[model samples]
Target: MHKKILLAYDGTEEGRVALLECADIAHLLRAETHLLAVMRVPSGVFLAEGFVPDTVMEDERQRIRETIDDGVALLREGGYSAYGHLACGEPVEEICRLAAELGVDLIVLGHRKQTSFASRWWKGSVGISLLERAPCSILVAVGT
Candidate 1:
């Protein structure tokens, strides 16, 4: 029985589905929820540039905050004790870090969605690496 849970919400279709599932599980376990939205910094050019511009950083921060806000609203309206934060870094790293920091017994996330050929070919892989490395147990929810 988990007393605390860490949930990953990225404002994606799959992630939204996971939130509903996490709510069900959390209610059953009477767990407190901690939602995390990670803003992944580009590992290529952005890292080499040393620092991101204030305008770009703020844009990303606001987006992440909105994601967290949505998650917080769901949990609150559902009568769950919930907290959330927006983080900047590698998505996988930040998610895992927040989970451990929260001392959660469970980490919840959605499986990555399939992408179009152009994106699949050009973009980086989804951060599924967190599943393999997380210290706590993970529950993956499928999208509708």
Candidate 2:
């Protein structure tokens, strides 16, 4: 029953698995797909480093854009009707916000297996956070 699927892609191995899964599901349901790559703002960079250069930020933005473009291309090559978006902000916030704005039926994201409690505590879990805040159903593709 899913008509629109949003894939949160970051070009990681897990992300690639998520992308493939998203594409397969979209194809089976004949749904439209949108790939979103969030460019997280370096909020703490200035505070930690004393100063942040504009060019460095710009380079990061460019890389995120390229990643989004590559995701869209791969989806297209797989014969899925898909598009890409680049957003700036927190990853969880941006993903949920875009999913709401697009009125998507499902959000697909990859999950990295965090083995240690310390790692989870330190990095937090974006997938878990999205599950809490997302307006639609979420499918987390856990990497083996």
Candidate 3:
């Protein structure tokens, strides 16, 4: 039984499904669900491009908030207790760090769109990396 669970959401097709799965598991275990969305922010790249505009960061924050609000609404509609959190930085690293900080019992991750041999052979899966590094149990919800 999980008392606390972290759901990593990328807002992709499969990620949405994983959110639902996380909510389901949360409901069953009576666990508190944390929905985490990590925004990919370019660190050195922005500074290299001279000065960063204020609107850029503001726009990103607004988008992140909207995503979290919508996700929270969906979970509540499904009768699941959920909370949303948005972080900026590398996705996998932030996810792992958050899991550790929050002390969650499990980390629920989403599998990206499936690809054929050629695609899979070219682009590696981040899910595998997260599963390998996460200290807690990982449940990968596959398929979009």
- Clash counts per candidate, in order, are 0, 0, 0
Residue 63 displacement in candidate 1 (angstroms): 1.6
After the best TM-score superposition of candidate 1, give how far the Cα of residue 46 lies from its true spot, in angstroms.
Answer: 3.9
Q: Candidate 3 — number of clashing residue pairs?
A: 0
Q: What is the C-alpha local distance difference test score of candidate 1?
A: 0.82
Badly placed stretches (over 4 Å) of model 3 are 42-51, 114-124
Error of 3 at 29 (Å): 0.7
Reference-based lDDT, each prediction: 0.82, 0.92, 0.83
**Highest lDDT: which candidate?**
2
Badly placed stretches (over 4 Å) of model 1 are 43-50, 115-127
User: Global lDDT for candidate 3?
Assistant: 0.83
TM-score of each: 0.85, 0.93, 0.84
Task: Report residue 31 deviation for candidate 1 (angstroms).
Answer: 0.4
Model 3, TM vs. native: 0.84
Worst 10-residue stretch by lDDT in candidate 1? Answer: 40-49
